[model samples]
Target: MKILLTAINSKFVHSNLAVRYLKAFTKDMDYDCKIREFSINDREEKILEEIIKESPNVVAFSTYIWNIEMIKRLSNLIKLVDENIEILYGGPEVSYDSQNILRELNGDYIIEGEGEKTYREFVEYKLQERSLEDIRGLYYKKDNNIFFNGKRPLMNMNEVVFPYEEDENLDNKIVYYESSRGCPFNCSYCLSSTIHGVRFLDIERVKKELSYFIKKEVRLVKFVDRTFNCNHKFTMAIWEFLINQDTKTQFHFEISADLLKDAELELLRKAPKDRFQFEVGVQTTNDEVLNRINRFVNFSDIKEKVDELLKLRNIKQHLDLIAGLPGEDYNSFKRSFNDVYSIKPEEIQLGFLKLLRGASIREEAVAYGMKFSPYPPYEILKTKDLSYEELLKLKKVEEMVDKYYNSQKFNNIINYLVKQFDNPFDFYYELGKYFDKKGYFNRNIGNSEYYKVFLDFNMEILKGDKDILNELLRFDYLNFNKKRGIPDFIGRSIKRGEEEEIKNMLRHKYSFKEYYLESFEIDIQTFLKDSIIIKKKDYYLFGYGGDIIHITEEIKEY
Candidate 1:
């Protein structure tokens, strides 16, 4: 029988590892199984036409919260095109509540839980080599009734084959790897909380699998493990293996900052700059909220470990804070935001709470008086402690953070501006309000417009020091973009032959052929072509055309 596996990703760059794993697991089967991937942004008609052209007897969809609505519509359309096409649903979205999903959608069968072994067995049953009743973790319709065999046992990590070797073309895709299968902590909002204890793959096998990406020079490989450092020994083995590899591939991990040990920190310090990145979930600093959500974390300890990591300055840290959780009001969330903001991570992901199906928090949502949108990605609308209006305010603040703080384009200006306020959160909150008031959020604006808008916002508040703000914004602009003429809004400092003087000063400092100054990390040639001289308190030359680096300290009075 012809079989086709489909994945609808949130973005074009995301490659679904689940479909790849399933296809790899059933490779030895005689059935012809092929995989097709599409993004949620793709037209439904285009996907439907492609699936019909495949003309497969069986089509299994990899489902998730982001793509469930589309899958529901696509599944119905596929059946309408051909009544005989047997549709199967799998992945975390359909893995739980198999019977309900089968009732809700036009799916003929549902594969619950881990599907590697179950799918292989299902393929065997389809070929008439085995009985349908014996296949575990499957919900199927026979004659007129639906049946679930039972929950499947967790498969051994080693039994699963590497997912990428079968297909070679992975250009511009973020490779997803899983060095372990489960989590030790019971964070109520997460799906990993439903599964107890961590199951690690063989460390040597993991190293071998990682070697493929290292050799391919994949841009990024994000580990899907929840709390990657739950097991110190297992985690360290992979970390150590990766550290020794002479590769440029960056690895990302979701880790608990509080779990970091002295040895782990020491090892991380030796890692190459930008070789490793960590995403730590600091949901809230309120102990009551933490206890209510079943997330037991000592914020002080987390801050300490994060501080140690910050000192290293090699590994990039992405700190996350969920805005809506039990007992966390807007004020409490502001505190949470400020607390994480103080740490100064490379990224502060200000996310809202989502009540995922099968997660412990979804069940406890009612008791906590939580209301969320009844749809895929069940985002929190209101909690007992937080109003819908307050949540919307936080949403505005989130937008401001994404544009200014996380973009790294306005680093110097943001660092300077936030100091003028009581706390960082208030500055972002006020900026967010300003954006909403000026009708800027609805318009599609360019980078120059953003600088102008930010300047206008600051002019309203910081009545004193307009020139300094203008120069700071100008410096921030030159730091990021090529030497586009300084915008009219951001006044220029260097004028009337100062450019030649600066060039002559640079020539006097370095050899004729030497273009790079190591201390400032600036190339004299590019600096001359794509840079501007601005003065805040002292004359400063800002370079562009590469990464955004601050040369504030390296500036000397000219």
Candidate 2:
């Protein structure tokens, strides 16, 4: 039997490890398997034609909320091309309630939980033309009877193969990996509902993966586990491997700061600069609101510990704040926002609650007067303190935060101009209101409209000249990030430098043009190695000159 395991990802940076896992641990000697990947840009007709030519007996497709609609449409097209082909669905979006989805979409079977062992067993049975009703963790129908094989047991993670063995070059800027299977916390608004228990993959196996990534000089490893620090022993061993990896690779983890111990904090603080980034979900600072959401984080401990980590100046902090929750009224939210703001994190990520399909909260949303969009995201309409109008205003606020606050471009400008704000969110809110009132968010307003409106807004607020307006605009567009603050953009962070010196092959800091030209004897390739970014316009420089002075135009590479 020939089986093609397919996973459609958003981009090359995204590798569906679950599909890789399914391929790695098939445990079937009677079948041959091929792994195929598809992205949004890939030609669907060509792909289907190619698959039809191969004539695989079975095709297993991984599903996720983001890719379901596209997958369904493609599945329909595939069925048209080859009606005899067997189709199976697995992964996050393949509801445990697959009876409904299968009835509507006409898939052969839908597998729930871990697919490795069950997938192999089902494949073996199929090879011998055996009955499908006995396959556990899958849903299938025959005539008027429907059967759901009982849930499949979890796989022995340690015995699984490293999915990247076939990936010739692991030289991506951002690659994701999982060290665990489930989340420990029962955050109501999360997909941890279906798989409520936590299970760890082998530490030695994880260390080997780290070695593989480090050998290829992978710049970033985004740990997709919900709470990396949930299992301290497993987490610490992984951290130790990362610390001693003898490579300049950076790692990112979404850890629960409230649960981190002193030793974890110490190890994190001691890590190399630009080597680690931690994204902490502070959801809300209001104790009652936190309790109402069935989230178990201690806001006080989160603030204290995360603040300590931020002070290390090594581990970059990305703090999150959710806009809509059960009891967080606008005022109460203001307090929560201000409370977290007091720590001055590197990045303040503001997101509205997404009512996911399998979250515990969605089941109870009706009781809390929550109205959500009936789509993949299922975003909340409004929760008690956050009214519809207020949420609309907050939506605009989200735009401003993405544009100004989170971008860190409005840092010095806001500090210099915003006097009435009690916290950073206040500054963002006021700016959002300004942009909304000026019709800046209108689709009809083009780039020129945006420049004009923002130019006017800045001048009025800053009481400054064209230079300051240009600076504010430049701050937003340039690749030179203050990363954590406003002192720099892509340009040099020189203050009060009124004199210019005649320079040759000038190295204007982050400018890619100069670096590319070997202005600093920097192998624009080796100096950057795999960590380099290819963007449009200027790389990250204010100005560079050999004889004539020229500014970078725009980013265009990647």
Model 1 backbone overlap count: 0
The model with the greatest TM-score is 1
Q: Estimate each model's TM-score.
A: 0.93, 0.81
lDDT of 1 by residue, 1-558 (tens): 988999999999999999999989988889989999999999999999999999999999999999999999999999899989999889999877779788888879999978899999989988999899999999998777899999999988889978887348877999999989998889889898888888888998899889999888899999999889989898788888889999999999999999999999999988999999999988898888888888777788889999999999999999999988988899999998999998989999989999988988888888878999989899999988899999999999999999888888887667767777999998998899999888889997888998887678877866646655665676667767656565678656656475455556666653423221222222323333444333333344433324433333434545
Compared with the true structure, model 1 gives a TM-score of 0.93
Candidate 1 residue 507 C-alpha distance from true site, Å: 3.4
- Every model: Cα RMSD to truth: 4.3, 8.7
Q: Per-residue lDDT tens digits of candidate 2, residues 70-130?
A: 7787788878877888888988777656778787775688888677777877887887755
TM-score of 2: 0.81
Instruction: Kindly give the number of clashing pairs for every candidate.
Output: 0, 11
Residue 482 displacement (Å), model 2: 15
Per-residue error for 417 in candidate 1, Å, reads: 1.5
- Candidate 2 RMSD computed on C-alpha atoms after optimal superposition onto the true structure: 8.7
The lDDT per prediction is 0.84, 0.69
Cand. 2 Cα-lDDT? 0.69
- Where is model 1 more than 4 Å wrong at Cα? 461-464, 508-558
